[model samples]
Target: MKKALPATHTSMMRYAVLSISLIITTGPAVSSALPLMAKNFPNISLAMIDMIATVQQFTIMIFLLISGSIAKKIGIKPTISIGLIITGVAGIFPVFSQSFVAIFISRLLLGVGIGLFNSLAITVIDLLFTGNDKAQMLGNRSAMEQLGVCILNLVVGLLLLINWHMAFLIYALAFPIMIFFWRYVPEPRVNKESKETHQKINMPVVWLALLLFFLVMCSTAIIVQIPNIIVRGSLGSATTASLIISLNTLAGMAMGFLFGRIYKVVSDMTLPIGTFLMAMGAILIGMGGNLYIVSLGTILCGFSYPLAGTYAFNLLSKIAPQGSETLGNSVLLIGCNLGSFISPIGVRILAKISGNAFIGMFIVLLVVTGGILVFQWASKHVSKMKKV
Candidate 1:
């Protein structure tokens, strides 16, 4: 006979799931509104208009470097609450002002808020669950994040039709999530003694983070290059490109939702498997002449992104010392953000060297994938030898 869990426990899980979705709300906050914003601010250069998105990403990177330390000092709950409040408040600033500088400031603040809680989502999940449950929750978190991106983008797109400023209102969703978090999510107890006893980060974890960096960099290249690739090839219009990208997002979300089951089947091999898929995707995109093949490549790349991310974070949680999940997540986030920031540059450099951008990107993906496979095999052999 099995004992049933209490209602309170179930309710808390529901609230936690809802609260975690806020972590991804910022993903499409300004992205969907960019065109309308450009029209509204006709005086600003297109590059500067693009800065409205880039500035937030830069802030997110900077804050990600420090968010773990902030959590340690202030406590995760307080840090998350503050982040939610800042995100909610600052995200709406564009509603009040049309000035480029004012909107930039708002986006920067939103980034700060996002950075504060971005890594913390995994940390909190690590605290609340364990073993298979933890894996399941992490998968669900990834799914919810992708779903949030889809929903917010759709909502913002609709709102942009009314007015760009209306899109900012989506950020206000953070307040309720903050309240849910504060009320339902238990604060993890800190052990002052564990601080002194913390172990150095595992070498394997560092290697995994590096691998993730390359993977993210490669995956992001698809997003950056697809528009130009399609336009230049005469394969599709901008709207078609957008639709393909949305399908890619949807594929990732579907994989995320199925991740728990997938993990059971793939287990530790998830990393290599995901890397292989990403490489294949990149190759398809680079070589495919038709729109269908390119769309398929985008979907595979999208699917692999979340699959790899979920497994990597799960591995990090396993390797991290007691009371150091936050720090581990911070390291992972740094790698992810750095990968994204450098992706465009990396592509351009490779394109220049190879004389063909698509081919260059394909080479990069193939090399990275080969490296990851070798690393995985070596690590497994080493482990087996240690057991002997």
Candidate 2:
């Protein structure tokens, strides 16, 4: 029996849906424990140890390709439940296993778990809500993901003080979230025959995916230079890096709450606003002479991230072909993940031209972003003129 698709789901049900976002970024919560992990495994190279933190991204991309297909077979709720289970089991797997390979494999599964549900997280919002409420929920979802990053990172930090193994316990939090989702959220009634007809990729999704790819590629490259700027300028200590990053996450969380209102006012122009702010953020960090300036820049970057990211998801909700929602989102997720992966190389390549790591990347991004902002504003102006 299928539950009726209502215009609105209950508040608790919405939160149950939102709870899953809390674990999306938890893959990196253990990053702070890397030094301790290195001490535990003397034979492992520092670079490999670092992979324990980032190896998730690679596997995320792999699982993203098939995430939709699995959801199709098992249904969304069960698919998400399985992903959460994988995350919980894999997350704590390191606590018991001493072998580096085993821990590394666990990290890989963490990515798999997140990848499986990443698209469905937003798909659920699309199905359960309508119009402004939908937009607001999407924003809340973004906020929730950042909130998870902020809280779990802190929890992991505190846990690290007791035992390096304790850091993995943070992933155990997923089981409760899984239980909440299973209990409160109803399985969306989907038309398998109709949805199955259009499994092929659509052009709109590809274009949006490209837009997100370029956006993330430039933004990530610019953000990556901030720590280097801090270190090179000798404006702050190593701890300052963590503080600035935290502020960045907090800024994104703040934006997620306000995004729905802001979107009502700006509509599609949110992309331009986001890109413009991102460019400004890079400029401030690259050129600013001190710590406070860099902090402001980092905050700007954070604020802009959810603005662009949520907007991408929102647009996809409306434009994604009915049956292939997860696949469309998977493409967008892959774009951003790829952007993060390529950012370092992009920064290194750009830095050579200007002889300053941050500035070189900032210059290109500023021009590109500025040009697009102008084009977008002009197009809107012309459209208004036509209406008048």
Question: Which structure among the candidates has the greatest lDDT?
Answer: 2
TM-score for each model? 0.91, 0.91
Instruction: Report the lDDT of model 2 for residue 352.
Output: 80
User: Which sections of candidate 1 miss by over 4 Å?
Assistant: 1-15, 25-28, 195-203
TM-score of model number 2: 0.91
What TM-score quantifies how close candidate 1 is to the native fold?
Answer: 0.91
lDDT for model 2 comes to: 0.83
* Model 2 pairs in collision: none
Task: Tell me the whole-model lDDT of each prediction, alpha carbons only.
Answer: 0.78, 0.83
| Tens-digit per-residue lDDT, 1-388, candidate 2 | 9876443467789889999999997776798889999999999999999998889998889888888788777888999999899989998998888899989989998999988888888878877777878888999999998999888988998999898889999999899999999999988767757456656568878877877887787666655666777777898876787678778888899999999999999987887688778777877887778899889988998898788878888888667766777788889989888988888886777668787655765676577667767866887999999999
Per-residue lDDT over 188-221 for candidate 1, one digit per residue giving the tens place of the 0 to 100 score = 6557875455444667668777877877787778
